[model samples]
Target: MNIIQIDRHSGQTSSQILAKAMDLHASGDLHEAEKEYLAVIARGYRVTEILPLLAGIATINGDLQVALDRWTTFLDLKPSHLFGLMEKGALLHRLGRWQEAVVSLQAAERIDPNNPDLLLNLGIALIDAGRGHEAVTVLKRVADIRPGNPLVAHQIRRISSAIVPFWHIPMLNDQPRNDAFEEGIKQAIAAHGSTARVLDIGAGSGLLSMMAARAGAQNIVCCESVGIIAEVAKKIISANGYADQIKLVPKNSKDLMVGENLDKRADILVSEILSSDLLSESVLSTFEDAIDRLVHEEATIVPRAITALGCLIESDVLAKYAFVDEVSGFDVAAFTELAPTRLPVHGKLTSWRRLSDTHDLVHIDLRARKHEASYRQVDLPVTADGIAMGIMQWIRVDVAEGVEFSNPPDHYSDGGWLQVVHTFSRPISVKAGDQFALIAGHDRTSLILMPAG
Candidate 1:
């Protein structure tokens, strides 16, 4: 029997060599341990067992190329080896060879599809390859595999940037938003009477039209861009016994015709199309299109209008997210580079101070026929001194009557939509009355803000 030596030159057994390698690994003598493992590998002894050990040693020694080679070698011998495949895939990912990483991870997933680690890696590899749709599928699978996982949830959100349809933004649901629209509809009916003709554009839930119907509107036309959501909205309307009072138009607001759908122009137009910062939901274009093509020249637009409100704030906690710094034995300053070119932030969870109190940013008159991209520089007076983490923003919609309603700071809670706190480049300090200049505007989808002179 050919006895394979584990100790290489010392003629020890494979088990003894592995023990030495593990001890070296434990003792932090990675380089010698790697050499010993490689010597055992050279003797053709227990390749499968020793390969991962060698790869790990190479990784600890900062020899990524060697580590990758060893892992790849191990996978070739035992393709179903889960850890080896993961190591190989991760190495490729770190090297920025995302396509190759995808291939390796897919191989791993085929062997062990239920592994959330492999699924996440596969999703990331797909994302790096710019296959966002595919990434979304895998990420969602990872989400399903590990529900409530922040990392999985985060990847799902990242993939959404590539797939969110033009209409998904406003159609998404929120309790505060629904209540605001419902209350507005009630007031509109109280003021205009129940016999008024109503049109609800971007009718996500068909809720507004139902509100109008309950408020006494004889005829209500509701339009939604998403086919599935529109179908659900219709079902909801039918379930609520308002099927006869509401007409669901499963199409974009621009597709609605005045004579065919309405039999005449509408007396009222009610919609809740405000995104986080109001304009991000494409309220300008959608409302502009509906007003120009569908709404009556003098319609009572419930959410007659909406204004984006904001304030500058600062915080150390926010800096961790929006800026670069070191932490926990690692130079994580590279993390700052990972900050989104733009991102939606929550103000309540962050630790920041007010550099400026809330002020009006931009308002879209929903009843206007056409809206041009507009901008204005505003001076926000700082009421207190604090590190400026970001701009906290929310919406104030003009519902009806002299009965104006606002989601004041104290009551402004979280849901599908909340105050978006957009972080600054660095924290800014200001004394009382220091004016923070900001340039604010909208370009169809979302509101943009930046420092202004």
Candidate 2:
């Protein structure tokens, strides 16, 4: 049997008030319990102990603001209070004050560095604060401490996917593309000799820089904009015994300074920033900036030209992904407007029938001082009778003199480059021997493909 607590209005000892507060809290009379706890604080008795209890009660009552204030007061009294800092950080995180939560959690981390709970909270706060690179670094430590923790592994994967594209590893494994770039790099080094300075703009994996080093280039500069990837590249370069010959610049090539970062303009410029669609990686602007500011006037550019090649395609699977006319017996053709204009599809993975012969859509000269957007309309004679989905596009790289690489759908497989399908506004039924007019061009950074009426 339980008895109701009696109210003493005046001259109660602080301990008596605290005992009554705990009794009220235990009885689920939170409102009165909060008043009794405040009375204890007012009487200046065991405030540090009472504040945490009050804060926990406030949190349970959905009074987050009051809880935050109580925790803040407790921290003021005991600045290095570990549990106070942890609770404050967790509260700030719930309140969406991510940076403040990170600060508080990090302070707690310094006090208890090996605590997995503190590290997990800090990682989440860093992620919500848009500091994904740092979050991954912190979460990796958590993974080490709690090995095979699915939550930690899941967080690390989610952050990695958000930060890097899936094709990066496959691109590194692309032998043909790697060989072509290596050949161009070696040829350039043969011509320029060991004194030539080689600049690799997007040194993904530092492969090209290592190639240059192996080819007797004494000076090589590799730049990768992503911080985590740059750190990985540094490790790989060091492991390959080229750390002394190659210097890694963990910044965008645009941010590089001439006299401070480089002794002189590079004699050879190498970059593989080309996307599956040829220009989606901002290759034009990046290359233009390099030519104008980062390289010698006569610098030998690897992949001196890139051409966009495309063919009309018809695929039931592609049509399903690109268009919608009816769904569950509902006339949802209007929903087709929301379909993606361009979708990357693996040439070997996706099944599509070619409706027309492959043709050159557009070509970019890497060494040109400047580029202007241009469009052209071409007539393609359809060779097959089918429903037209859109143009399936690929890339051909002229990587230096006598070195070329093309990812045409017919022959190329298991490479980093995937064909991009430019979806039409609507599906069109076509017959063999019909001439189809198609519009193709670029908007400086992306290739444009459209059906011409």
Top candidate on lDDT is 2
lDDT of 2 by residue, 43-120 (tens): 788999999999999999888988999999999999999999999999999999999999999999999998998999
Quote each prediction's TM-score.
0.59, 0.91
Q: Give lDDT per model, in order.
A: 0.75, 0.92
lDDT comparing candidate 2 with the true structure: 0.92
Instruction: List, residue by residue over 293-337, the lDDT tens digit for candidate 1.
Output: 666677778777778888776667656668876678878876665
Q: List residue ranges in candidate 1 displaced over 4 A.
A: 1-179, 190-192, 325-338
Judging by TM-score against the true structure, name the best candidate. Answer: 2
